[model samples]
Target: MVSDVLLGELAALAVLSPAAAFAALGAYLLLLRTPSERVVSRAVLSALSVSLAASLAIWGSAVAAPYAFVPVKLGHWFATRSYAFELVLLVDRLSATMMVLVSLIALTVGRFSVAYLHREPGFARFFLLLALFSTGMLALVSAGTVDLLFAGWELVGATSVLLVAFFHEREAPPRAAVRVYITYRLCDVGLLGGAVLMHDLAHSSQWGEVFGGAPWPGAAASLGPGAATALALCLFLAAMGKSAQFPLGSWLPRAMEGPTPSSALFYGAISVHAGVYLMLRVAPLLQRSPAASAVIACVGAATAVYGTTVGRVQADVKSALAHATMTQVGLMFVEIGLGLYWLALVHLFAHACLRCLQMLRAPSALRDAQEIRAAHAGEPLPPLGLAARVLPAALVRRAYWLALDRFHLEALQERLVAAPLMRLGRVLDRLERRWVAALSGWPERAAVEPGEPDAHAPGAPERAMAFEPAASDRKGART
Candidate 1:
């Protein structure tokens, strides 16, 4: 049997390996010019290999002593009279499994990207973000407290956004990145709120304290129905966003703007499964809250229906795969809500592996289709999919239109949420401009004439009349 101290060391190594690589690569990029592609690939691959080894070792130890749950305390971040924020790491069946999966997938993607993105200008930047993502995911899986998990969660989100906008010169990637960032930010409030609620109700956000020390799926949370329900709902909201559940899922298809490797890593595999991992980690709490479970089930069912309907009508392979992934993820959520925690975990693993493979091969789909047709003696491929065979003609046509328009979810969101927010932002911008003018003794110029275009409005020309240069400034420019 592995000693507890050895297990602690191994778990810490699993998380720190990638973190150290991220720091070193970041420093090298900033201080020195971009290192050779070989160097970047080696650094990232080596880190992932180490992390994977550590995770496997931890897993072996847990298997030797079935139902093992180990909590390793690194140190305290701060100490107060009532609360001491200690950095803790956990090694358990679920976490060890997740750590191994994340490390393996990241390593595979990093290796594939070397050849796939060869000669690309942003090679170093891509590897750097990949390293950061690996570290964040490792930390998220192994974190012992909600506070630590939240930090890791935010790190993952930031890296995701950066990678989505990796092609900084492209207009669409940045816009898509912004959309994803907004969705993440808005939903992350649930995680923040849940953390606060846990601290208040349980007096500690530590998993051991909140869910008890027993191993997961068997451990029971010591909370009243009311408290458990509230906390469960909040965490589920966070899960809904990360997993791309209904109404909040539109941003996911757009996320395909990033590189194929990134799309596979983030959407097809580990990143998309993060929410299911969270639900599994908190299975005990969900068991205690029937109301919360019902809500989760309803949302999951809706998303599953939505994804399946829209996926079939997608004209592109990547978009189709994105929606297909959403469909599987939604079913996983349904499994969790139905209290089939083990089944949900199995589904997550299988779907992630399959989807990752599909996404990696997505770019070659057209070639594959050609090969298939040639094998069939160049006969036109017969119609595939159940929709054509099973659905009534009228129903299929109606569904097609709805799916093609994505059920107008985006349009509704634009009118109800995004438009209002933009108007508010414009109002705030005008107020700030007026305040600045008052401070700079240009108050008169701040007043806008009726029907005149706002100088800062989109596509409107900059009005020189807004701020005429002073005579002394003009003379200085001439000299």
Candidate 2:
């Protein structure tokens, strides 16, 4: 019983340690001046260190009893007659493994950033976001209920967008951040919808309730084919956005605008694999629904192909590595769809380590290449695997053009989706202004439109007042 209590406390600490650090840092930034660089770095590292220790302890306990499942119930947030929201954390082999991975990687990144971002203006802000991200990721992996998972998922998404736009002064970073935000917002509908469906179908959103009390990979969800398919696809939609698969993946390479440590922590390692983790968590749903599995496999295969083809044509080292990461994540998704859950997990862990190292080294890649060329006496290197050598010239040229242009995915998305939505927003804004003018007894022509000069501006003609104070009141005020 004492051991159980200790394990539960450790699980809670694993999540709350980083959260407390984030709160402290955020408070300092808001109520007081930003802390010194050393202070910020040490605070973040200390938080992650504590989290890592707690996670390692949990992992040790899990190892002692292999495949151990421990659910720590904090309490119920609210309870309705038909529905109750509970806060629960699950520490099993899967979540414990993920917790250790997240904590270790975040700790390493935090330490690396102390030097990498030295003397930078936004150093404190970057560490603050990193701490918040650690908390979110820990919460995500340990969440035993869909509601808690969604909260963590949003935290991860929000922080990812902010980090991608870390250099907010730059034009490109903000634009890329917007693109990522849009993709996440659209895909998050799947997670929310899936949660609602789970509640309605299972009478609860708890994993134990939805998938039975058996352990993962063996637990079978008690749901029919149609219901399982709907839920699985919805959840997979959320995964697709987070994972940066295929058509939704253009925002990833652009996300390289952030600092290297953030790039490594988010895109290369933890954040990118979040979707696959979600899928693995619900493996039984896919097993129940063949249609869902087939769709997942097909999309994963297409994303792998797309990533490989485009990755080859990227001019920059970071973009190429981003696409390579995407290809590997795509294959992991395929593994999950094929019901190779353990293999997918192993692949995820190994790939995350490799990709994080590559992202951190990306800035030095060009210098390394130049040094190699210098050592070779400036001799022109042979094109060892040029497509031109084997393929027809015309076909090779066409393929190169397609790959270079990223198959026009961005252009097509703008034309079909973004452009129309923007026009509609503009129209809605004009209509809202007209309605406000009508209700306020102002002339329709006097209504302000977007991008137009305001009538209240200094140089513009003043509009007639809708009302005036009484003359007696005005005279009293003067007196």
Q: Give the per-residue lDDT digits (tens) of candidate 2, residues 303-355.
A: 99999889998888888999999999999999998989999999999998899
Clashing pairs in 2: none
Q: Could you tell me the C-alpha RMSD of candidate 2 in Å?
A: 8.7
Residue pairs clashing in model 1 are none
Give the Å shift of residue 117 in candidate 2. Answer: 0.7
Compared with the true structure, what per-residue lDDT tens digits does model 1 show for residues 1-479? 89999999999999999889989999988898889999999999999999999999998888788778899999998999989888999888889889888998999899899999999999998998898899899989999999889988998999999988888796778888888899999999999999999999999978987898888775557899999999998998888888899999999988898999999999999998888899889998988888888888889899999999999888888889999999999999899889999899888878888888999999899898788989999777788778878989999899899998889998788779988997998788778878888999978657553456666667556654464544421110000
TM-score of 2: 0.90
Clashes (N, CA, C under 3 Å) per candidate: 0, 0
lDDT (C-alpha) at residue 327 in model 1: 94
As a whole number from 0 to 100, the lDDT of residue 457 in candidate 1 is: 67
Query: What lDDT score is found at residue 442 in candidate 1?
Result: 79
